[model samples]
Target: MEFREAIKIALQSLWANKLRSVLTLLGVVIGVGSVIAVVTLVNGANVYVAEKIYRYGADVFTVSKQPRVISSYDEYRKFQKRKIIRLEDYQFVLEHCHRCQAVGALQSSTGKVVSGTHSTTDTDIRGWTASMPPMYNLNVILGRSFTPTEEEHNSHVAIIGTDIQDNVLGGNDPLGQEIRVDGVPYTVIGVGEKQGKSFGASQDNWVAVPITAYQRSYGTSKTITVYAKAGSTGEPLNAAVEEVRTLMRSERHNRPGEEDDFNLDTNDSFVGLWNQIAGGFEAVAVAIAGVSLVVGGIVIMNIMLVSVTERTREIGVRKALGAKRSDVMLQFLIESATLSLVGGVFGVIGGIGVAQGVTAALGFPSSLAVWSIFAGLFVATAVGLFFGVYPARKAAMLDPIVALRSEL
Candidate 1:
């Protein structure tokens, strides 16, 4: 028999048993769908994470009360026990770190803000020096930032975030308006440019004021957070970090091997931590998806075995009509493969829909890569071939006379 004829027969057989074929494909559908969903989510999360990291700039590093990433709850608890980053340390880095392009100190706390007839329930209030805007690459959309002299004098003038502008300032211009912070009134000297969001945070909606003002008004203490922007080239970042470390050690008057009081962090360190988390999630998802695929493959194998048994007399008829054993095997294999491929096609579409729906509903980024689709399809086809081989072989190896004699 011609290969085309054998394929037609195989397809007709599958179509005739629609319910069985559908059931047999379910495992494949589930497996492929799961794989696609996971890959989409992971890819999306990676893109989001990368964007968030790059926002901080490659040349930027920070020294604060704690490191950027912590692996475990125990480690986080240990970090919480560490001393806060102090104003003196920030001053030391600014004065001594030559490799650093700029250094700034900041502190933040949540407080209520009131203006006229309106009030905000709670808002993030940050205190920083004149160097902060440049280090963080923040641009003022309107008005001017507080000057270095204002920081020195602990001026009460403030910069309002976008959200605050809409809430407190209303339709009126925010610049030169007075807003109350924790009951103290301050003039809004500037409005920050909309910086969008990253890492699930609204970077645009954060208010910045003078560090000295923050300390005195809120009793924020001398503890501060410091970020350093390294030079544009070479290992300046590393050198800058070392310089900050040495300077801090000398300022604190620490001896050799003594634990440093403050922590330093970088974007690379945060990325590494994020990957470790993503990797664990991927492993778990793969394991669960693997189980579904295995179940689907077993179903395919069982269905194929049943097909072989049901077609015993038909097989005999074909063999007697000059169909070779190889032809018999090829036909069965093709039938199984066709069923799996059909399942995979539907599965890919379903998975993509599911991923898209999730992204839309949850406001999460979910990207479907070309490679994921290819991988899903390839696996589905492979499952059909792998699981169908045994049943196909069994059908092919049967004696024509014995097959003809079988009652089914």
Candidate 2:
């Protein structure tokens, strides 16, 4: 029989029992959908972090007391023992590192910001040095960043985020406006450009003040995050980092055999850590999806076996009419594969839909790879073929006279 003719008959047979075919497809659909949804979410999150979350420029790196991504309790405990990176540390790098182009220090905490009756809680409060604005990509859309002299004088000036402007200040002209941060008053000098949302949380709900003012208010015991940018992005950046590392080691009193006392994190390091976390999620997703696919394949195989039993007399009649054994086998295989392929198509669509729904609900982006869809379909078809072999063989080997006499 022609291959096309066999496929047509297979599809027609499946269509004749619509309810049964659909019931058999549920497992495959669920399995493929889960995998695709996970892939989409993971990929989207990775992209979002790389492009938006990790805003440190190629030549920029940060110095902190601990690494950004801590994986274990032991590591956390170890990091807790490191000495806090302080303003003097920032000054050390600024004054000593010839390879460095710019250096800045920042300290942060969460606090309440108030403007008359309007107030917001859990708002980010940052105390930054004068040069941090450009290094960290913070732009003042209105008014201007505080001058270096202001930073040196411990001026009580603030740069507010759009969220503070809209929610706390009630959309009033924020420039030159007075707002209270944790009960300490600061004049708003500029409104920092809006940063939108990250994973459903507002990124622009923050205010920045001079580092010296922040130290006076919040005290100097708290650690600070320092940033440094190499003038160039290439090999000079490495030399600059090494220079900072050497100075930091000496200042922290680290011996020649000891590890550095502080952490230096770049955009690439952050992304790499994030990817490690995402890789674990992907592995778990694949394992879970694998189980669903296996169950689905088993269900298809059982259904195919029943189909072979029901079509015994049909097979006998075809054999009696000179139908080859291979023809009978091919038709049954095609029917089984068609069942799974259709389920796979539905699964792919449902996965994308679920991913989109989650992205909309959670504010995480959705990214679909074209290859994933094709891979899902191919896997489904392969599962069908693998499981269909037994039933196809059974049907193909049936004795013509005995099959014709059977009641089923």
Candidate 3:
């Protein structure tokens, strides 16, 4: 028999037992669907993290009093023992780091901002140096940044985030308007561009002010985080980090051979942390999906065995009419593969719908990769071929005389 004839026979056989075929395909459907859905979510999360959390420009690194990732209470206590980063340390790095093109400092606090009867609660208020806007890509969409003189004299000028403008000021022209932040009045000199959402939370819910002004209002006791940018045409980021580290260690009076008390983080560090987290999730998801596929393959094998037994007389008739063993084997293999392929097609559609539903319901971003769909289909087909082999061989090896005499 030709391969096409075998395929036609296989399809006819499946069609004749439609309910059984559907039942046998349940495993493949679930396995492929789960794999595709998990992959889509993980891929989308990676993209979101890269664009939002790790959006710092190349050649920039931040210096702070403690590590960003602390695993235990002991570690947290150790970090707490480290001296708080002071404004003098920021000034020292600015004057001493020749490889750096720009240096800035930031201190953050949370407070309520009131504009007339409107107010925003628990809004982030950042105190930053004049160079912070360019260093951190904090673009101004309306009005102008406060002048250096304003920063020097602790001027009560403020830059509001998009959320503050829309929620607290009711979308009015906030430029030159006075808003009270934690009871201190500040003139809105600029409005920052919208930063969208991250991790299901709004990023544009804050106000920015000069670090000097922040100190006057919020006090000088807050820990400062220093930012430095490498020169465009000069030293590499590693060299710049090391330079800052050496300067900080000296200023903090760290003895030689002792571990430095501060932490330095770059954009790559954030990416690495995200990779560690995302990698773990991917591994667990794949393991669960693998179990489902394996169970589905077992079911297909059992069902195919039953199918061969029930069709013994039909097989005997086909062999009596000159059907070769290879022809019989090929026909069974095609049936198994067709079943799995059908299941895979349904699984892909289901997975896409699930991903979309999750994104819409939770407001989380999800992106489907075309390669994941193709990979899922291919794996499902392979599972069918692998599990179908034993049943197909048994059917091909059956004795024609015995099979013809057997009951249906």
Candidate 4:
């Protein structure tokens, strides 16, 4: 029989037993849908994380007393014992780091802000040097950032986020308004551009003030973070990082073989950490989904074996009519493949739908890639073919005389 005719016949058989075919395809649908959903979510999350990491800029790096993430209490203790990164350290780097295009220092804490009776429940309060505007991408949407003189003089001027402006200050002319942060009044000299949200959390829920002023108001107990950008990206950034590292190590009196008592983090470091987390999630999710595919293939094989049994008389008739064994095998194999391929098609659609549904409900990002679709279909078809072989072989090997004698 011709391949097209075999496919037509196989489809008709599937349609005739619609309920059974539907049940058989369920596993494949679930497996493919899960795989696609995970891939979409992971892809979107990777992009989101990368964007967040590079929010300040690609060339920017931060030097802090502790690493970005501490996995254990022992590690935290070790970091706590390290020398604190202070304003003096920041100044040293600012004055001497030639490869650096800009340098800044920042420290932050959470506090409540009040404007008359209107008040924020909580907001991030940051103290920044004048150089932070350029290094930190602190885009001032209203008025302007505080000048070097203001930072030097410890002026009580502030830059407020949209949350502080709209929620605490009533969103009128936020610039020049006075808001008290933890009972300390500051004149809003600037309003930062609105940063919408991330993972359902508001990004625009913070305020920035001069480092000098913050130190006096909040006390100088907490460690400060130093920010810097290379004169250029790529190689220059590496050169800048090394120059700073060498200077910091020498200043801290670290012996030649001893490690520096500080952490240097860039956008790529954050992205790499995210990738490690994402990779593990992908592996676990895909493994669970693979089980479904295996089960689906088993279900298809069982259905095909039953099909061969039911069509025993028909197979006998075909053999008596001079149908070659190869022809019979081909027909059964095609039927099995068609079943799997059809399931794969539906599975791809269902996977995309699942991804979209999750993204919509949770506010988690999702971006479907074209390759995932093709991959789903390919896996489905392979499963069908592998499982169909035994049934196809059994059908092809049936004895005409015995098969004819048997009744269904």
CA lDDT, candidate 3, residue 176: 86
> Predictions ranked by TM-score, top down?
2, 3, 4, 1
Which run of 10 residues does model 3 get worst, by summed lDDT? 49-58
Please report the candidate that would top TM-score against the real structure: 2
Model 1 accuracy (lDDT, Cα): 0.82
Q: Candidate 3 — what's its lDDT?
A: 0.88
For model 2, give the 10-residue run with minimal summed lDDT.
Answer: 50-59
State model 2's lDDT.
0.89
TM-scores, one per candidate: 0.87, 0.93, 0.92, 0.90
Q: Write one digit per residue (lDDT tens) for candidate 4, span 26-81.
A: 98888888898898889889888887778788889989999888879999999999
lDDT against the true structure, per candidate, is 0.82, 0.89, 0.88, 0.89
Give the alpha carbon lDDT tens digit for every residue of 1-408 in model 1.
566775676678668888987788888898899889888888889888877666668878788777766658997888787766777788878988888888898888888888898877658888988898767667788898878899999889998788788877785888888898888878999888875544345555566789888888877554677888886534788888888888888887878998887787887878778888888897899789878888898999998898899889999999999989998899888887877878888889988988888876766678888998998899988988899999999999999999999997
Q: Return the lDDT, model 3, position 230.
A: 81
Which model is ahead, 1 or 4, in terms of lDDT? 4
- What lDDT is reached at residue 277 by model 2? 91
Query: Best to worst by lDDT, what's the order?
Result: 2, 4, 3, 1
Off by over 4 Å in 4: 9-15
Collision pairs in model 3: none
* Runs in model 3 lying further than 4 Å from the true structure: 1-22, 232-235
**In every candidate, how many clashes are there?**
0, 0, 0, 0
Can you write out model 3's per-residue Cα lDDT over 122-233, one digit (the tens) per residue? 8999998998877768789999886779888999999999999998889989988999999999999999889777556678999999999899998888699999988542
Candidate 1, residue 51: lDDT: 74
Tens-place lDDT per residue, model 2, 326-354, is 98898889888988898899999999999
